[model samples]
Target chain A: MNITTKLNIVPFVSVDSMMKLVLAIGIEQFLTELARYVEEDFLRWESFDKTARVASHSTEGVIELMPASDGKMYGFKYVNGHPKNMLEGLQTVTAFGVLAEVDSGYPVLLTEMTILTALRTAVTSALAAKYLAPKNARTMAIIGNGAQSEFQALAFKALLGIDRLRLYDIDSTASHKCAANLANMGFDITICASGQEAVEGAEIITTVTADKKYATILTDNMVGSGIHINAVGGDCPGKVELHRDILLRSDIFVEYPPQTRIEGEIQQLADDHPVTELWQVMAGKASGRKNSKQITLFDSVGFATEDFSALRYVYDQLPRTGFYEELDLLADPDEPRDLFGMLLRAKQAAS
Target chain B: MNITTKLNIVPFVSVDSMMKLVLAIGIEQFLTELARYVEEDFLRWESFDKTARVASHSTEGVIELMPASDGKMYGFKYVNGHPKNMLEGLQTVTAFGVLAEVDSGYPVLLTEMTILTALRTAVTSALAAKYLAPKNARTMAIIGNGAQSEFQALAFKALLGIDRLRLYDIDSTASHKCAANLANMGFDITICASGQEAVEGAEIITTVTADKKYATILTDNMVGSGIHINAVGGDCPGKVELHRDILLRSDIFVEYPPQTRIEGEIQQLADDHPVTELWQVMAGKASGRKNSKQITLFDSVGFATEDFSALRYVYDQLPRTGFYEELDLLADPDEPRDLFGMLLRAKQAAS
Candidate 1:
């Protein structure tokens, strides 16, 4: 007679449940906690095994897997960007991630990442600007207002105390949508007509456009001295936002160099070109902004470490509020060696 | 007035449910289809964007993410291994994967890879042996009889017509369980006491041990000349099965070079060691077994392409067989950009 056993499996955290988790935690509180997690991980920058995201591109869009670990826990995110998906009445992006124990390679959590990605990207931008931008930066100039615009606005408010926003979009309704969403969020707003007008007096200029081309949304002439530029949109081959002259003039700070070189604004620059890794700056090994007249550019290409930090933060915080559902994503079998036995029981249960 | 919209979300196939899916698809049919998928993808070996898996390791185990694309479609599998998991009543390995369109990067299919990983490994072994081993190879020696032993035996039978199996395990009860499962399937089996005894006169030899430490399961003296050795279990940094002499005597073939150098049996060899990729062999660009007197060593650590092929196969086969349920994993809102609206609706539903 052959004796077999079973393993325990966890439940999954679907997109709906994730949304509830955020709403339950309250977006404001979530952003504040997220800021701390990102900052903490950024500080311990050397402990992680980091890499640029591995991407597979097609004519329409790209799907990527971003993985990173801090010697103990491992995290990887599956994300896709399909700008054309909106035309088909689908999301411009969708994502999910796994948080696993490095000691055993068992996934402890599996959660939807579409909403989480938005929150993290916004939080990352806010965290970087907190250190790189001007000390009293109160107003931000946002160009290419789209799906990610509102999150950026909210994170800036939550992290940097940026109560004033100047917004511009090629599509006027996008600005209207962003302005309308922040109608009573305790922020002053200016709906500018063009990119030039939007950044005229703003202290920090954030570019989050959705074009897949080499977009010069902010030219050299428009960039003012001492204004820190958060170049967020140009994050891959053939995608960029700043004019070549802006990178030529600014003190460039990047996520991971190899990735930023291929995906961030530095893709426009040469191989031997100089740039600063954001982790190094956070680690105090490198300087951020030297003087008020110096232009500091955080060429944000969305690093795997940021996602790793973000996912870990969500995993820690969501459970505290009792807002997340436990996902049975890993199997805990009764007999460690008898995987086939699990199937036998499932078959019996079905019939 | 703001129109609130919500997408109906559901939990897709989690690791535990994949165990259920394997049973739902029927182990025999799943293996058969898996063999077909593995073969189909191998035939078109040139059409893939392949890379080494990204791994994050701790002292006890490792978690890895593997991503690949064939231009039209994309797939990624997350897998982990821990020899100590079994001591805690957990499986030594677990895996899950996502299949998506390259055009948009949105996953259309997500699956449990624990069962599928076994199936693919077995099918890959059988397929490699088909090209390298004797056409009339009838019997196979199976060492390290664990969760994957049954699949290895069956895949060889289905793909290579090996009707007889000689099985051996350090834990003899594992062999007993394997023989019991195959009692109805009709294969004459020899339950041997040792790896050497298991290999007596078998045309093909399969070594898939679970122990993470270096153990010479099959020494050069045990494996004869002209035998096709499918070394499957000697994966990761510290694990290996065959003696270095076996590799010295055999013609080595691998899935991907850089990965095999780190994880496969070839890790024993030098960095610049010459080996043929299995695809080149399968595509007839390179040779398999050069002569009847030669020993062929397939250093199988598994690859992203095999998972990509297996995932594509699962996605295509599941819908037709009605073996899976629709998972509302992604948000499908009525209005494309109104993800916030979904929250409003969920709030109403809960209230």
Candidate 2:
């Protein structure tokens, strides 16, 4: 109720404010609550207008725009992925998003989505695991201990009650950094030497290594029956984390097939390879984990609706947390047709 | 060189800053310089990537994303068109855009585009007229007197030395308002009773009425030879201003053919109807106006690269004018892999 009343002012959540809000609410509770929003949207997934993200790929990296609308409110995220950015001391991914009213076509909220994306991605993985992971699973093996590793560890702990984390990365410092960040966050952490060692006895495997090429982080021999594989890193053309044999043996559940076929782990499989829509499973139209020993792979190439849900959740929290700044992003003349007059008056006032 | 050195800080130009920058540089001079930037991009048009805008249409209005990149710098604009918004005292079109570095996929500038769009649209039209309009033409008629009317009037005067004006709108008050706004700006003005009367004795006719339907502002009979038509308002599917017969008679020129076929005045023409690309003419690869009697129509459905050029121009002005604020839009961690650590530090700092 204390938000900006000016028509031209849009509420903007900066990175600092996002961090404060997340910490204020407690990270696990934020993830748990955000998961509910994501699930609510997934339940009504058929109602959303979905399209594959428009991407501009370059030799250095790719920039993308992901847009979705539920006919009432529309949301879009501007995101970029450059695997080589790490060597330059920058994030491999950075993002921001906007939520607007469809009726008026006016933006209501703009927020930094780098942090929210990590949160939503982890929550989505854990939400899928709730249906596909073995009952009472308490251990999760995260194969890449990069920027997204700790969030995955915490989300699993918050949603699935999985507190045991086995973390591994090609860079050992990244594994140590992940363990250090999750310290006192109720996670029982282990720094593992290899992907094989990490998944030795883990019930859930989350592969989120950041590579722009087809480098298999999960070999067929590393994956076992009844293990839920969350393929997070293999999301774009020529990027894959899991071996083809591993995907062939698993029952893949995807966010959107059209996008997944091009960007998810399923990109390695044949065009006709069957995959269940996760929303159908959530809506009870399709089954998830038919048997205890069935290998369920949530081929998680993140969807725009998930970002929409995250933005909606963040917008709803603005009133309670007061964690946003009003941005003068729109030109609002006193008379809609008098935009030039507004500039002239401003010049006169300055003189 | 005085901008922020912080990696996460992006320079943001709000509406107020945009108005100030435009006024500081003088509107006509600003339009002239921006036209040069736009013309420069058009001259090297083949080197850039182009796509039809991604649009989400609702019964009430439409929201669109226009994106383009020149391999080194990428830009995109978020814009909306809601004709009914005018009845509710809102602008029919509002927009904002971002310019980013393609190498790192990092946004360098974020600015309000509603004002910039108006400037660029006017400049583009005048630039096309330079190639397509009759030499030394003076008198002009603008069919719409809404938010974009004054900008078009000034851009024509600035670029082509046109000082005589004739304006008309369905609402006479809009025309009166436009005339009053341009008062003392060195233009000989006349208010017309109808679109036909507005075009009388005018060398260039600009149709920019803001109706969402296929309402004819210019018919075949009114379009005489040796007149260049700058059609600005018929920029979406099912929204057109010129009569189909007028399109058949004119040598239509467009920004991009793939987009014009769906959203410009050319939409009324046959699929294979001959239309010249404006960039080809600017690049000297094609002819613009073959003779003085040829009827030339520039179907102006705005493009992404124009927004790119405008944003680049504004960004270059920031150092001289100091009219931007550094926004904390991206999350920067001390270690690229320690995003969670950054949050923990934020929490500690807040406490």
Best by TM-score: 2
User: What is the Å distance of residue A285 in model 1 from its true position?
Assistant: 3.8
Q: Write the per-residue lDDT of candidate 2 for residues B192-274, one digit (tens) a residue.
A: 99999999999999999888998999888998989999999999999999999988888989999999999988888889999
Which DockQ values do the candidates obtain, in the order shown? 0.55, 0.90
Q: What's the lDDT for candidate 1?
A: 0.81
Query: lDDT tens string, model 2, A1-351?
Result: 326779889999999999999999999999999999999999999999999999999997899999999999999999999999999998899999999999989999999999999999999999999999999999999999999988998898998999898999999999998898888877888999998999989999999999999999999999888899998999999899998999889999999999999998888999999999999999999999998789999999899999999999999999999999999999999999989999999999999
Q: Which digits, one per residue and each the tens of the lDDT, describe model 1 over residues A208-308?
A: 98778888999999998999998888887999999999999999998888888999888888987999888788788989888899899999878888889
- Model 2, runs deviating above 4 Å: none
- lDDT, candidate 1, B90-130, per-residue tens: 77888888877676566777777887888899989988998
Q: Among all windows of ten consecutive residues in candidate 2 chain B, which has the lowest summed lDDT?
A: B1-10
